[model samples]
Target: MNSKIYFDGSIMTAELIGEIDHHSAKNARMEIDALIQQKKPAELRLDFSGISFMDSSGIGLIMGRYRMMLLYGGVLRVVNVPHDLERIMILSGLGALDIFERQGEVYECT
Candidate 1:
C-alpha cells in the first residue's frame, strides 16, 4: 500500500492507496506516525478512496491512528470510504467509533 500525506495548517490528511494488509500496514503506520509525532496536528483524516482492497489490518490501522490522535488531543476522521469497505469497517465495529464521515452521511463526533 501507498499513502500520500497532506498538511493544511492544523489538519493532516493521509490518502491511503492500494491494498492494506499486514505487510503494508506497518509501513503506513510508520509513515503516518512519524508525521503525527512531528506535526502533532489538531486533526487527522484518513482517506480511503484509492484503496483497492483491505483486510483486518486496515481496521487496525484506523484504530491505532485513532488512539494516537487521542493521545495528542486531536480528532480522527475516516473519509471517502468505498461502499464495500464501509461494510467491512462497520462489521468490524469501527462504525461505533464516531470516526467515519461518509460522502452522503455524516457521523457526529462527541
Candidate 2:
C-alpha cells in the first residue's frame, strides 16, 4: 500500500492507496506515525477511498494511530470508507471510532 500525507491547518490527512494487509501495515504505520509526530496535528484524517482491499491488519493500523493521536490530545477520523471495508471496520469494532463520509472539511474537537 501507498500513502500520501498532507496538512490542512492542524489536521494531518493521510490518503491511503492500494491494499492494506500484513505485508504493508508495518511500513505504512511507521510512515504515517512519523508524519504525525512531525506535524503534531490536532486530528488525523485517514482517507481510504483509494484502498481496494484491507484485512485485519488495517484495523490494527487504525487503532494504533487512534491511540497515538490521543496521546497528543488529538483525534482520528476515517473518511470515504468503502462498503466492504466498512463491514470489516464494524466487525472489528472500529465503528466505535470517529468516522466520516466527507474529506477536506475541518473538524473541531471539544
Candidate 3:
C-alpha cells in the first residue's frame, strides 16, 4: 500500500492507497506512526477511499493507529471506506467504536 499525509491545522489526514495486507501494513504503520509521534496531532484521519483490497492486517492497522492516537490523547477517524470493506470493518467491531466518519459524498457507517 501507499499513502499521502496532509496536515490541516491540528488534524492530520492519511490517504491510504492500493492494498493493505501483511506485506504493506508494516511500512504504512511505520510511516504513519512516525508522523503521529513527530507532530502529535489532535486528530488522525485515515482515508481509505483509494484502497482496493484489505485483509485482517487492515484491521490490525486501524486498531494499532487507534491505540497510538489514544496514547497522545488524539482522536482516530476512519473515513471514505468502500462498501465491501466497510462491512468487513464493521463486522470486526470497528464500526462500534464510532470512529467512522462521513466525508463529502462518502457514506457513513451507522
Regions of candidate 2 where Cα sits further than 4 Å from its true position: 100-110
Against the hidden true structure, what lDDT does model 3 obtain? 0.91
Model 2, CA-based lDDT: 0.83
For candidate 2, what is the total of clashing residue pairs? Answer: 0
lDDT: worst 10-residue window of model 1: 101-110
The clash numbers for all candidates, in the given order, read 0, 0, 0
Candidate 2, 1-110: lDDT as tens digits:
99998888998889999999999998999999888888889989899999999999998998899899999889888887776676777778655554544546532221
Candidate 1 stretches with Cα past 4 Å from truth are: 107-110
Q: Could you estimate the TM-score for every candidate?
A: 0.93, 0.88, 0.92
Candidate 3, 79-105: lDDT as tens digits: 888877977786687766778876654
Worst 10-residue lDDT window, candidate 3:
101-110
Could you arrange the candidates by lDDT from highest to lowest? 1, 3, 2
Each model's lDDT comes to 0.91, 0.83, 0.91
lDDT of 1 by residue, 1-110 (tens): 99999999999999999999999999999999999999999999999999999999999999999999999999999998887786678678877787889774785333
Of candidates 3 and 2, the better by lDDT: 3
